[model samples]
Target: MSTPDTLAFRFFSLHVVRTRRLGPSLVRVTFAGDDLAHFHSGGRDQSLSLFIPAEGRTEPGVPVEEGENWWQAWREQPDGVRAVMRSYTLRALRREPDEIDIDFVLHGVGPDAAVPAGPASRWAARAKAGDRVQLIGPAVTDNRAIRFRPPEGTDLVLMWGDETALPALLACVEALPAGTPVRAWVEVSDAGDVQQVSTPADAEVTWLVRDESCAEGSPMALGAIKQAELPPAAKPYVWIAGESGCVKTLRRHFVGERGIERRQVTFVGYWRRGLTEEQLRELPED
Candidate 1:
């Protein structure tokens, strides 16, 4: 494997090597490639954009070009031949043999309580060894999308995430300095969807399982937030993700109702209520 420069984004071709069923709604796909030895992930909440070939397709045609506007070149490809591109968090990375893991939430229920076999979900749920894909990610350790920065003097860490952000949030907890104080509220679809997360910090995690009667986004989510008695901290660093509208509502509540400063919170809208990832990308940031 060739080592790329320390400050660059590059495409690496990887192949599925294993798969695991983590819970009722989560599937983990592990991939490996010789080139992954060059991949640099900053650990917590690090994200990668994967170009996955449609099922039964073998090759993921990543352009040989490297440098500025690589995305423009990718966009110019014909729709029929283009791969499905989506952003996902790196669940784990191992370099001894060059491997990485990605956890996909199997959402979009079908009639009769079935799981929808969408592009990414289908691939992950049925992924087999030798399945190939292209990953565009940091070749360096300090990429800009690694949104775990908390300002100095921060004494507490507060996090709220739906299933989509669970891997990232857990990664953060796994790496936090021992004895740091942390509080997290994670929402999932059902009791079976709850995942075990451990941290060395003085940590408290509350899991909220959504039932069929629960409305999408902020209605029930806001009610749950209001009902919890939050730990008091002089300086709390709040991180929120999941549904776009829900994230926006929580952002306002933290700053307006909770009396926290706008700068003290870090938030990202991972997805929306009714839009696909591509459609969500086209919208202005909330």
Candidate 2:
């Protein structure tokens, strides 16, 4: 929220243009606004802090000034009057109409859901055209929020992610250069969440669907990667994200067990099991 004078990031007021169901558990929300003309991103796992209206509110409450102290002002507001903020990835951006797409994983929205849906999921589930929101996103063509960086001299790209990270994983894949070799594993709660990825890169994507046999919040990535055969590459870059516990396990597998250099791998904990987003933020990173 307190950006440097370069102001690589800034706030944008946007409204939902449409919503499309990608699968039983995923929805793509497209947003457009006059302010998008100033938004810029290098793509590939770009992060955004979205502020949605609080429950029963028609629009989000944002800071009055777009200054370095905007975060302080927003945080000082009464809890009931402040907007609910959540982190999400940019799925796609189009220039013709100045629109951007964000994919939301609708966790716990079904009748038999074991856990109740969170505010962001609930909001995204019912999002309709003209619904207003504000987001803090990149204003520079290249910024730090985009984390899927494969360093120079990398021979192969490896990735693993769960439903919560699918949007980012897909964006990274779509941005790879032509003929780049990539191996990716995506785990989803249901087979319906599997998607078609189009990319110029030579990417091999494997979808792992959890059924009744797989335990909730348990990771399948470690075992799957252990048994699989990876294409030999001297310098391989790895990216893993999803639940915090699973991400740590996979990071260990790649760095500690597989002997991949720690610096060559990027891991993000999108969420932690049994913890609310605010609760997760309060805890120190492991």
Candidate 3:
């Protein structure tokens, strides 16, 4: 029952049929619809743009009648558009008859927060068996590749992120080569924000928590990383993502100061403090 439009671009129409709490601040929403059949199955660290329709609206925030020209329709919409689009990593993709599951990391309350009790989170929280919405982007191809394919003989993998980047972290852990040496540093708002992550037996995972006033950038994870002794193997791959400032600091330290080769590390500014996703998107390339 899927339409050609669904496969044409990374966008699709979806209906939320189930929801679950993965942790205090994280929620996983499972969506299904005929359009899901066209979903691209690119794994770990892959991100897609979700276009959530406004409340009480039956049609998508952007018209699907544009077929492959949906983005044009979105730009040309009269009342502008009643939708909120957020960038989210595709944590996992499972193929079924006509559906897919997209897990979203729900950040807490605030105007700058991507889903702060906004239409996307609200709909996901209350979504029943029949609720429908529109999804867009992953946008076919951005300059950055969706999945990372490490070079042969990669001895170790180092990954670091805050909760905002957890979906990508989870996907990376799940897809890494079996028994690959891994060191992970994850920062969370509070101790309770930590969630159990499954990684290969050889992987070493560390959870860093910030106190009430500290939040994520309290230098906890960065300090730990500074003190950590990396395996003495040449050409270990590093993947870092989180707040822009924090990530930029690490990038400066690792790639800028330490002289690590750029290709050996992937640093992403997943989000930034005080900036909306749109603002973050508008930032110049580093």
Minimum summed lDDT over a 10-residue window in model 1 is located at 1-10
Better of 1 and 2 by lDDT: 2
lDDT, residue 220, candidate 1: 63
- Which sections of candidate 2 miss by over 4 Å? 1-6, 211-217
Clashes of 1: 0
Over the stretch 183-272, how does candidate 3's per-residue lDDT look in tens digits?
889887656667776765378889987654665564877788889988877878888887888888887777876567788888877678
| Stronger candidate by TM-score (2 vs 3) | 2
Kindly list the per-residue Cα lDDT of model 1 for residues 218-283, writing each as its tens digit.
566678777878778899898998887888999998899988898999998788777888787777
Best by TM-score: 2
Q: Predict model 1's lDDT versus the native.
A: 0.80
Alpha-carbon TM-score of each model against the true structure: 0.91, 0.94, 0.83
**Ten consecutive residues with minimal summed lDDT in candidate 3?**
1-10
Global lDDT of each model?
0.80, 0.88, 0.69
